[model samples]
Target: MIAKLTDIEALEAKGFDAAYPQKSPWDILRHQAETRPDKVAIRYLVDASDPARDEVVTYGDFARRIMGAAKLFRGLGVTPNASVAILAQHTPSAQTAIWGAQIAGRACPINPMLKPDHIAGLLDAANAKVAVIMGVNGELDYWSALVPALREAGVTIPLLACDADAQSPGADGVFEEMIQTASGKDVQPEGDETALAAFYHTGGTTGAPKLVQHMRLNEAHVARSCAIMHDLTERDVVVNGFPLFHVAGAFVYGLSTLSAGGTLIVPGRLGMRNAAFMGSIWQQVERYGVTILGVVPTILASLKATPIDADISSLRWLLTGGSPLPTELADAVEKHTSVPVRNILGMTECAGAIAVEPVHGTRTPMSCGLRMPFSEVAVFGETEGDADPSKPLGPDETGIIALRGPNVAAGYSDPARNIGTFLDGGWLVSGDLGMIDNEGRLFVTGRKKDVIIRGAHNIDPQMIEDALLAHPDVLTAAAVGMPDAYAGELPVVFAEMRQGSQAGEAELIDFLRDRIEDPVALPKRIGTVDEMPLTPVGKIFKPTLRAEAIRWAVGQAAEALGVEAEIAVDEKLSTRVMVPGESVDAMKDRLAGMPIKLSVEARS
Candidate 1:
């Protein structure tokens, strides 16, 4: 289903147009306005002192404003194909900016909350033609301050201000100016399939950012995937507080909802820490009957913690992704809000979620469901070297995941990325260790690079992390595979306690005894930490944590097990065992002192 040059036009006709009437994300929005002009497209929840009052946006009005913003950009000489960067919180304006960019030419969605260094890096990397800065609260921090920094880092893009809150002094007229231009513009894109759409960035585990170049045709395919995956229709309404920068924010939920003719609900920000802000989202859900809600596990976890539970009955389903959902968090979220929650799994390299659990799932369930349409999946045998698909493993056989499909990103911003993930054959290495069951469900087992080997038995860090988080008192946990001289690699778990609650390491060890099927799978060291290290997206940052824990253990993990005074020979085989994480060289050095004889038969 790779959109080949030969079949692209045909595929475009059969796949995209059949599913959606409007050509592009922007066009679909405009079409929604024309067909259902007065329909509500977006409802913005504005936080108030009491946490009940909020704002709203009708589809017809949303379209008019988007057009106005596009016109404003046009008046500012924001020509077609010029990259426009959006630096703002997840809100109606952010969505408007993205649509405006589509109408204007090109849009580069950026995380406004990104660290200054990363922000500068991405700006320079994109060589953005212009930047539209939206206020991050009252700080009024505009993109103007970033101009000099971007120049230093190799970017000279001009910066403009978006109305809400901008910090720059004496800048050009705000986004309103662009909106005025879009209103008056007598010309529009002809829904051209050849038009370049947007660029998305992905940096999962590889620790290096890679850009995903999407053409208009690819976006249309992504829209179709979203439409089907979410079960979206004209009657549906979504509260899209998810960041526009993340895949879940744009491709997974946002643009898909629009193409489906469903209304959108946005908030000033998705920051749940501010009860007032979060309450606004709940208000929209209740007042406007926001049926669809998409968010990350971390955000959902925080929302579950909020005590005030007003009416959220309008929310029929809540979608969570970006990281594995801890079972405890999932259960708590269900208890707090009656909405159904499903875990979605995929990456930016892929347009959106390739696998997601059903919407009506009861309680938190395992396994992201059957592969979506146009997805090719294979689980290669988990081995030490280059992955081989010919020797693919069976159900429950943990291995690297390789996928090829229409929605997969064409290539990274850096062509060199293809060397590791994509071969000449066209498959994309997911870089994740996963398995497909006979039922065709996919279970992601941590990063392939994070596999923990203890003794001869290989361990999955994700498995132990799952067990640790299952503890009632535990809030979040991360298990890092550390070097051990005897067994090869042993796992050290760093965990955090729930707020205002304390649980000892002994309790954790006992909990593991009840949860884990294999005795050896229990964590060797349960280290209590204030919190687990996490990336911006909340996935465990174990490389640095693993290094820190090894130092604290003081070589205990590296020590060999001392022999008992009288070693009894067992007639039966000791199937359940603890072998040391020993390298070949270290194993030989330790074996030199033992009386055990090396046998060719055993070695073979």
Candidate 2:
């Protein structure tokens, strides 16, 4: 029988998996290698140099590579429980490194896009002894300049480079080259299920990001639960484009596919410039007979805009998460693709997904669906004069959504962030606001945290706000999310300029571009406000600012289209523009290129 969230107890529960002893993620690979050595395990689609060729890795070869990397780790003096940080763009080699790190030591997948300072802070927090970084590529060279930057920040960890030049300093040979030469006989993992396996960094409410710790046991448990949820089998072909650093890329989608002995397909990183890859996604799905696909809302939007002519009858379901999926977009996808669209809800703290729309199940618009087996969810709220904010709220009452189960991370790396984030009963206090119906289905309303979900990446607006405040012309600044049709949300800033100083939107945007390494965090528009809404205690009233930002985005969109419409913005910032005597398709066509996303409806 498949395990349910209620069947599992706390992390400290004795003999937690006594009925079914957990297996290491490496063991899952070994079992598949032995059982189906010739079976194709991974296929890399859309090679930039050769678009026609796809690199395939069989189960046996995948296991051997992991074993070889394990031996290489042992040779480098990495012991069990040691932390190894990997910083590289999404690639087959990067995924191989993750498996190798877990077999020998703890794997910490650092975001490749982070600036050197942020990278240093993460490496320091993980206490990584060795860092594997991208080599001297044309772009995204994590080794060439990042090594010196990390060193300057007092991080003296040994460096391993992927595709590094032979003469590069601090490079202990190439990763692919060393792994091939190493013997695969001495691979030994001593950790049990509960032993720490990986450290994933996620944006916290604070200025600094928090390190989420997951155990091998958590991976095993989550994988099994997910396998059953998706009805995964050996015949299933799963495709994913999320980076391996993210939980879905590593555990929920990746490990779960392995757990069911299914073939996992890793496409190249998702970007607009890679039009060659993005445009041919449907053809790739047909070529591989892709049974299951995972995508963010932005990808769906792109696919809708550029229709691909390919037979997708083999596709069983298209799973979407990471950001809010619009009801209209979902309907459009289903109508075009003729595949069941399942919207899932998950977080890094929750290993991967805790809830998903069941196969052939009915769905409520914008609802994240029922909680999966073995995962417990509750709505926690506060009552007037109640000392405990952790009190469980009644059904249908909007409150903070708290989760508990084997899937949840053990705890955060920082003790300070751990406070109040975890309740007395081990329930993780998700910064999201939601409500559960009497039927136990969850409806996510909004986020209490100030972070914005920009496509696949979780952007911390405070990072940008802090940078804007340092500018001489900026007196006060607040960054918030503005609704977008393509990207779920775009970062927008509202700033009150100094009385005598002058700063325009373009100039401030240039200032932010120079300071912030991540362009996603940069504000799309900067509105000069007379005064920001402030609470009685002098804190910026962000809710009011967020509402204003959404309205402003809608107004701009309407003015650009030259359409007089009545617009209504929901709590999630989903806009509905009603234009008298205008057809939905025509209105949509007119507002196609607008920054804000609005659904065009005709008023009777």
Candidate 3:
């Protein structure tokens, strides 16, 4: 195991090719199973409150289960080029399905929370030959609704259910029973390093999802890099509550810990969403002797609020990602838990990790640490849609970020979507705006599409968000652009207050007024919500906030024109405002300055 990473160059000196000899994820798992058969690979909590009920899987058993899963998929006609779609929570069976499908063919892990039609579209997009879904259980039930939707969508793939009731209908077979018929000894690894291993969908909530093709090499590269960067060892135990659908759960925390021969502790079926698990998470950490705790910003905030009733001295690092880690929140968490918070920069296209703050390195606020070894991360001048990688910007020059490395995915499944993102020369353009310092630390500003344009001036919503987050009463904050009649777009802030804080929007806006130095960046209005809308992976869902802002803007305009307006926002976030026939021209004139396809029509 790596002792520590003093510098990125020092880590790179140990040549990447020589350090990671494993060609695929299966190869790494096989090596571990052969070398340390008795070592615990996964410790699954059956109930967070009961330690004795935990189910443990040794490396030998885990490897065999993956092999069995592979054999099962292959027996069901899953070829090397076909895919095995998975729709389950963070359970042992789900883990098996993911790795096993990769070995036999390819794994397409879809979000179980998505609508049936969206799930069907993803299954169709991946060309899945078979699907394994979580069965109708007391805690979760997606089968009843999903089965008919797939049929309606004309998706006739075979369906298998895991953790299902014996009498559950609609499923062709049970995953556990079907796998028992297939012998693990007969399974063999298929595909080369460059072959496709998984199909991960991104951004399906708004429009058609883009399928990211992760090759075997990409997963292997990230596993090794993450293990080394996090200084993981067999002696360490990691608590990873992330879901399997996200790359952070599958690779960044899951495979990375196992690849290093460490024990991975998965929270119960509901994972972090389980209130009991989260309430007693500290006790569980102490019970498992967890050395590393992986969580998103939202979980971290919840942990900070939850009193530490148990001895958690074993935790060495609180690794957070999947969203911008507010410096204030990180500082608060570190102060409360006395554990250093290490930030990670990741994307699904890059197999989950682009950079990680070294466990032993100095903790720099707002910095995502050094780039991964053997990968090139550069910033370029922001163009219309794509940034030119040929001309890289200098240090401290804030611009668009681009990356190229073995960890990068081959490309999206839809080749047409690769024009701006997957460019020539193997460079994958990161839509995030960031800058590298002279010391090689990456500081991500925000997403390129997240910038709020105020006339000719470009305003970053992060500035407003950071200011609002500085308030002690604020629990979560997000900023978006509201359609403005004259300024094109104006900054608006949304906040979720801490429990029982009684913080009002006027008071929070007053607090931000003193903290914000730039006049243009100051929010025009502040709104409060019971809770912030978060993605399944726990990042703040900005699109929802943007849509709310547009609706609010249209309401204000209609009120001024003395006419009622009906606003409809489509999946693409295009707004259609229907008003009285007499006010159509006035409404169009009022909203003409906004940068959107504003369709103001007379109410039919």
TM-score against truth, every candidate: 0.67, 0.89, 0.76
State which candidate has the highest TM-score: 2
User: When superposed on Cα atoms, how far off is each prediction in RMSD?
Assistant: 14.5, 3.9, 14.7
lDDT tens digits by residue: candidate 3, 1-604: 3323346667678776677889799999999999999999999988788889898999999888888899999888888888999999888889999999998889999877666666787888888999999888877777877777777878788899997754457888999878767864566666579999999986432235578999999999998888988999999899888888888889999999999999999987888778888878888888889999998766776776778988999999999777656565677778889999998888888999988888878778778887888888999885545698767899999889889999999899989989888989999987888899987889886566566655323455776787788899888899888876546578899989888897777787788765654455678889988888998889898888888998999899889988999999875577899998999988876664454545889998
State the lDDT of candidate 1 residue by residue for 1-604, as single tens digits. Answer: 3112223234445764465555567777777888888776765656534335555667788887877767665665566656577877667777787777777776778755444455666665554667776633463353555545555665555566664543455344466555555546543754476466677765421124456766665566666666665678888887666667776777777778877778766655543334555655576466667788777664675567556445876678888766555454566677778767777776666666566664633332446655555556778864445567667788989888887766666676678866667645557777777888765668775466565544323355666778778788888888765544234345678888888766788878888765653455678788877867777887776755665544433234225534111111222211111233334334333322111112111111
Error of 3 at 436 (Å): 0.3
Candidate 1, 190: how far from true, in Å? 7.4
Model 3 residue 43 lDDT score: 90
Tell me, by lDDT, which candidate is best: 3
Name model 3 segments beyond 4 Å from true.
1-6, 205-207, 451-604
Q: Write the per-residue lDDT of candidate 2 for residues 1-604, one digit (tens) a residue.
A: 2222222333225454542244668878888899999998887764634646777888899888888888887778767757788987666677788888888888899877677777787887777878778777653455777778778888877777874434456676788888899974767787677778889998623346589888786777767666766678999999866778887787777888887788888765442235566667788778779899877877777766768688878999888877877777777777778887777788887777767665556656777876766568888775542213558788899888888877777888877767666656767777788898876678888776567888867877888888899899898999988867678788899999989766789899998876875656878999888898898889898877777776776666667767677778765555687876655676675444233446778887
Span of ten consecutive residues with least summed lDDT in model 2: 3-12
User: On a 0 to 100 scale, what is the lDDT of residue 463 in model 2?
Assistant: 82
- The full ranking of all candidates by lDDT, starting with the best, is 3, 2, 1
Estimate the lDDT of model 2.
Answer: 0.75
How should the candidates be ordered by TM-score, best one leading? Answer: 2, 3, 1
